[model samples]
Target chain A: MSLTHREFWMMVHLGLGVMFLHTFFEGILWLHTGERLRRLRIGTGVMALVAWLTVVSGTWLVYPWYRAKPPAGADLADYPRAYLLANPSISQWHIFGMEWKEHVGWLSPILATAVAWTVLRYGGQLARDRRLRQVLLVLFVAAFTTAGIAGALGAFINKVAPNTFLDG
Target chain B: MAHIEIDPVTPSIIEEINSLTSSSDRPALPNGQAGAAILSAGIGSALLGFFVVLAEASTTAKQLMTLDAGVGPLSGKTTFAVAGWLIAWAVLHSRWRKQTIDFARITMIALILLGLGLLGTFPPFYMLFAQH
Candidate 1:
């Protein structure tokens, strides 16, 4: 079945949210580690920035639709827009769903993979380090891996389910 | 006796002076001075983000553009602000100072929140942006 514009845009928004959570957590883990690997830190920072932007833009796009009210000349055809504006709670649900998708979706696996890579490459040093450092490193690696997987999955979904809000 | 009256410098005193002189002569490493550079970069990025957003929100150029196609300056500015914060934290913690628990936690939480916001754009909700 063909998807409606609202459904498509919602999906994209949700996808972006998932992406943001993945990258955000990874960034935190990167920051937590005391060892400053310049390249790694830079990568994390850039990823975080991208993720942040994606979410903000996505939210901005959906906000008006969520808050849409029936224009004087509008009718049932504009229900999607009207529903969004008349009911603030719908927007909240959308926001919550987006959050859940970001935090709980594929973020865990992606982060895990990235963390594993980092550990394998720097495992020897990490192993030799203090317990606190080791723990943080493990956490970092895990978060990174999970984010990566989630990100990939999100992209796939986007390709298959392109947002079509404007078409409405 | 007069010639011998010249006070002999103590070896211990001379050794102490030599040690002090050596300690004071160490060269500074540029790489080791990463703090200033990192801080500058972080602050600079944040400032740029802030200004861009301001310009976008207030500028006539932004108004003339199609609203649906472009994000305008607000979202871009917010992204930059978040980025600036991340960079600033990295620089401060990595180079200038230690990462305080509160500071680190706050930044991480903020990132997570932003991520959650991003997720709100997914399927079902993706229609919010689709052109009519």
Candidate 2:
């Protein structure tokens, strides 16, 4: 069965979210075990791949789709554009948050690859080194937090933005 | 490559290290290899975007931009990004093979490259932030 653009994007988002959770759990496992998990490196690699997909879909596909088919008339009557547009402060914050999200979203995949590379190059030594482990932990947390925030901002955008995704 | 024979520093540490080093399929890449991938991908994509923005395109060209060439600055931006990353990987991979590279130093070098690539993404860096 063919899926609509909105459905496809939602599936992509869900996949991205799941991958982030998996990476976080893998990180915790490594930390708790105090042992290097080879498979964790593989997990990070997969997470990076998923992140790349999210970036491409969000940046190239979804943005253009939204730009081309902004919702209108009765389609947006129930949408909460006023809560964002009517207030200058809220609008500014939303725009600022989105801008940051765009850039940071790009950074996530890079960070993921770095984590994987570090794990592969360092082997079990990374787990033994307190500082390196801390660094890896921090990067993982940053990637996870960024993905969550981006997802949240995206939901907000769908509610307020002039987009065809909601229009029947 | 100077291999460090690290004694299992702690009992809690797994015996996996010895096996890891012995594994042929999962080769131990150099310390800075991962950073190189990050730098290459970031810089490559940005450079592609910059060039596309600089180019003059007709309405047809813009409309023709689809998934095959969509999302990034140009068609195959991801492909270019991956290529750049792999090239860096190969270069760094070979460099570390010839000499002893420390982990901390590898990290610092990677950070420097990443910082440069990040800076490169902002057009202002090329223009010195002057209003063009």
Candidate 3:
């Protein structure tokens, strides 16, 4: 069966989230041994790209449909945001979960892009500077954490109110 | 045993790397450029939080931030954040590119700002500021 536009893009977003985790893992390895700085640089760049893809797609393409307001007396089935909010029991999923996810998720790409540009600009100098390595590591991990939180929330939110199709 | 030629003036590869990383007097690495990037990331994050909280607290701000109807206020919030981040990055990078500044201070400040940004995005925190 062909996927709805929403389903297709959300799936792509999920894939990009996984890709971010993979690159973030590479960054963590730098703490143990600073042997492969070049690889770490590449990882930063990849993380930036993946994060941009994930957030941009989620925000611009998928979010419109997710947050599409249901008309009065209309069925809330297709509107994930409204569906979650309509039910007293599940309202927290939208109020807390989606609220936090959509807002915090944007930070990942910004942080990732900064890290990528720094690594690309400094290049080999990073390998020789321990302070630089440590600072980058902390921010890199923070980037990963933000993306991770967003990713987990997205999964849980979708499970609660799956975007099976585009409503509007 | 084979004799290795040792240069009297130049340090060994390992020694050079160790000193470049750890020595207090070694200030020629142009690390300020890197610090610029790191600090700006924090600024960008904090700016995003600022916008989120602003939108939450002010109805007018929320309406103004709705740059796109479909995407809602998030469209403006993110756009402004990204724009602010780039502007900060450019300003910092230009000033610090040729100089070597203290990395430790920059790192501490950046992390603190990042923590605040993280807290600001929290629904419980930002929602408390929401205008009922």
The alpha-carbon RMSD over the true interface for every model, in angstroms, is: 14.2, 5.1, 4.6
Per-residue lDDT tens digits of candidate 3, residues A83-115?
998899999999999999998988888888877
Q: What TM-score, computed on C-alpha atoms, does each candidate reach?
A: 0.34, 0.60, 0.88
lDDT of 3 by residue, B1-132 (tens): 999997874555665455335533444457778888989999999999999999999999999999999999999999999999899999999999998888889988888888888988999999999998
Single out the weakest 10-residue window by summed lDDT for candidate 1 chain B: B28-37
RMSD of 2: 8.7
Instruction: Looking at model 2 chain B, report the run of 10 residues with the lowest lDDT sum.
Output: B50-59
Q: Highest TM-score among the candidates is held by which one?
A: 3
lDDT of 1 by residue, A81-141 (tens): 3433345755433343333333333223223323333333332243233542443344444
Q: Which residue pairs show collisions in model 2?
A: A60-B71, A70-A162, A71-A163
TM-score of 3: 0.88
Q: Point out where model 2 deviates above 4 Å.
A: A1-3, A28-36, A69-94, A125-135, A162-168, B1-86, B112-132
Task: Report the lDDT of model 3 for residue B80.
Answer: 93
Ranking by lDDT: 3, 2, 1
Q: Tens digits of per-residue lDDT for model 2 on B1-132?
A: 999786765532454555445553454444454444444444543443443333223334333433253243333433454466667667765665444446565555545644544453333342342223
